[model samples]
Target: MRTVRIENLPNRSQMHELYHGRGSLGANRMKKILVVRIGALGDAIHALPMVNELHRREPESEIYWAAGPSVVSFLKGHSALSGFITVNKGVKGLFNAAKLVRKKFDCAIDTQGLIKSAFIAASSSNMVIGRAWNSVREKPASFFYTEKVEPQKEHIIEQNLELLEPLFPNETKFEIKYDIPIHEHPEWKFLSETPILFNIGGGWWTKLWERENFVQLANRIDKVLGLPVGIVWGPGEEDNAKYIAAHSSAQLAPPTLFRDLAGIFSKARLLVSGETGPLHLAVAVGCRTIALLGPTAGTRNGPYGKEQITIEPQLPCRPCHSRTCADFRCMPMITPDRVFNEIANKLER
Candidate 1:
């Protein structure tokens, strides 16, 4: 099916000039591309494969990314991106974003299926592309795409790649790689050896394994590997972090930026976390990750690629994808021995 280019958008002649005579970016006007995937770290990480796929297909496309303030900071100055536009979240944010994204583009794709994100892509260029009605999280958002796709794949990462098919139909099955630079952290001086980073999270409470279980796993790792393990935490979870640190042999790792987290992951012997942002980050940076999954679907959101392990609870109500569950035994069902055994198996390699 032919892509439906919107009215008043550039024609093939203008497009040729935009795409540098449908060639590389060296000559005259280089092709400009915009991508919209705003908010929350894990979803953004899942969208990275699409961005890398664009670079591989075009090789010279000037790719721009738009993300929310909290998430934008993580993606700023990323090597894969040509530039970044931070979408502020407030009454005047969209107005500000409309002005920021006014420039014309060769194509615009919104991997984020929210209407706001679709509007951002819509404002950027007329050639907006996104998921079809059935596949999109927000059904109304599909109206903005000039080309809406129905994904054939189940995994979100693969579904993200399917969105690119309208633009580059032939480029399929490329490796998912995040080429961002890992920053150095002097605060990690305590790790004289390859250390384990146990990232604790409070997001999606139903997905979290028991904190006491984490304490047990920490002690087990220390006993088995003779390595100093660290408990990583973010804002608003200080009390819980401290509790885990106090209850186990794991040290309280200093609070970290996304870059610092990248650094930490680069040197980490292994990383353990529930289905959250850091787990995705660990996978993005090629860190060995053990995902303790419960309410979330392990097959869809779990760590992809090698050097990864996922411990999923097989309860009947598990993988409900619900944010809250009163009697959520999915995580509680997981014993420290189960996780410790998985860690030991991963550590042995």
Candidate 2:
């Protein structure tokens, strides 16, 4: 096993190896490709643009995604993707990879670049492209990839996009797009009229701003703009959603499916959320978004799109990306007045 640390984007020679022509002899003849990015919901959503680019570059090639069970539902009805293979994150996941190897994909791209993802890519095929595993926290996984694509930036979306640069050489002509099919549901009828929707939960506790702050912001929006605010929550976040709804003048939307959530977000005037799946989803569908960042840096995992706004307080220790925060002060430092003022300015423009 070899470890390579990629601090910056790959140089021309490295890019040539990773993307230009296919590698040595038989590698160029491969017709089927597997893209593996199995992780947090937001990261999974970010991977869509790259997947779309791959489909465009190789229209006839079968592009299958190896992802976790949680992301399967999002990819279920996508037209650009061939299918998804579920990989559990532990010992059983290795067995799952061995099963996939029997199907025999010609090439695999491990977008996640973790040990588990690398193992799956290694088990499945010989032609693999991914970030050097050593560059990640898990070092031993680098053995899985045949080619290492070092992107120029820290932003995950940009990194994922750079992975496909080899397949398409012309930079200006390559347009990245994610087509999320809208499912018509009467349950989301209220959203058709409501212009603003706010998402209140994410995987990290530290990322969530104070609930009272959200209520105050909602109240201000309702009073100033007269726009109805719809609150969105994931499976385990109903209680928090209810609390926000109870205290604020905003309306509570029914629980939304991942696919349908895109539609709701698309129709909204603006979306306010912490770093979460819905924020990224909203950006994908071209909705205006206001995101609050605490431990996470907006530069890396911020919302992607033209109409997005992010609020992050400046603290020396901020963006520690810690799962737990010793000081809750970082998030509390962001006030309703600052957020509401930004929202007011955005809506006015």
lDDT of each: 0.78, 0.76
Please identify model 1 stretches exceeding 4 Å from their true place. Answer: 1-30
State which candidate has the highest lDDT.
1
Task: Report the CA-based lDDT of candidate 2 relative to the real structure.
Answer: 0.76
- Report the lDDT of model 1 for residue 179: 76
For residue 48, model 2's alpha carbon misses the true position, in angstroms, by 0.9
> For candidate 1, lDDT tens digit of each residue in 280-304?
8888888999888888877788888
Report the lDDT of model 2 for residue 69. 79
